[model samples]
Target: MSKYIQAIGIWFLIIPLAIINGGLRENILIKLGDIALLLSGIILSICIFVVAYLLIPKIKNCKQTDYFIFGIIWFILTNLFDLFMYISEGGGIKDLLGSYNFLTGNLWILVVITTFISPIVVSKIKKRKGEIKNV
Candidate 1:
């Protein structure tokens, strides 16, 4: 299969995992409040990045550009999914967007930034490991 197709497949696979993460985050917030939510975000970010790093190499024939494009698509899809969930749960668009506010709501910025960067970081890490092995 082509890299683009593989990327799309990976994006689809990630959606459910993202939803699960969101659910876990919500539960944690309900139980422990914002501090736990923030900590969970950091932990979840690390776990997701590690998973991406491990999984990216399995996509045969994917180039660095493909990884980056996948990251962008994943980022966009995740935010849209979040918005959908928020609205489905009876939230207004304002509430959906307000969670992105760094000052008050949870640290969604971390997740946003991590989503944008994870694929690129994974690609570079894999490339570096290949170089080290070749040397």
Candidate 2:
């Protein structure tokens, strides 16, 4: 239970990183035109991985499967949160779904995929290094 709490708590940290990334994308990366979205997605993906690498190992008694489950939870929650935001902003299904169109330079799908995999990937690395106990 505590492990679940800790894993969910880590997501709070990710939310701020994502907001900051959005700010950077809007303020700085936007100057780069169409590439800004892709670059920001890459940056956010790296940030998510870094956060997971630094913190997931601290989750007591978690195996790689637990980490993977955490990733799944985060992925679902992340999408839900985005959906809520879009809806709140007067966006309908099209607006929400449109974000996934990578051909239009929106890398939201990549970001979600990264969010869905970061914890497990980090756990694998930590397990390889013997930095975590339960594998």
Candidate 3:
């Protein structure tokens, strides 16, 4: 139970990272044109993985399944947050759904997928390093 809570707390930390990433895309990466979206998505995914690698090991005694579940939870929460943001900004359902179209160069889906895998990937890395035990 505590581990789950800690996971959620760590996810909250990611919200700020996302905000900062978006800010960069808007202010700095905007000069890159359409490629900026792809770049920002990649940057955010790497940031997410780095965060998971640094924090997931601290949740002692986590099993492989636990890490997978954490990823699933974070993925779903991220999607929900995206939905809320879109709707709040007056975007229709179609707009939100359309953003997933890779043809448009919107790599948002990739970022979500990355979020869904980071925990599990980090767990494997930590286990290999013998940094995490009680698995």
Each candidate: RMSD:
3.2, 1.3, 1.2
lDDT of 3 by residue, 1-135 (tens): 589999989998999999999999999998999999999999999999999988988898777899999999999899888988989999866877887898888899899999999999888888888888745
lDDT of 3 at 13: 90
Clashes of 1: 0
Rank candidates, lDDT, best first: 3, 2, 1
Between prediction 1 and prediction 2, the one with superior lDDT is 2
lDDT of 1 at 98: 83
Off by over 4 Å in 1: 131-135
Ranking by TM-score: 3, 2, 1
Among residues 3 or more apart in sequence or in different chains, the pairs in candidate 3 whose N, CA or C atoms overlap within 3 Å are none
Clashes of each: 0, 0, 0
Output the lDDT of residue 50, model 2: 90
Alpha-carbon runs more than 4 Å astray in model 2? none
Q: Lowest lDDT 10-mer window, candidate 1? A: 126-135
Q: How do the residues 7-100 of candidate 1 rate in per-residue lDDT, one tens digit apiece?
A: 6576566666666766877775557766766766676677667767767677776667777887887788768877888889898678767877
Alpha carbon deviation, residue 7, candidate 2 (Å): 0.8
Return the lDDT, model 1, position 119.
Answer: 79
- Against the true structure, what is each candidate's TM-score? 0.80, 0.94, 0.95
CA lDDT for candidate 1: 0.71
Global lDDT scores for all candidate models = 0.71, 0.89, 0.90
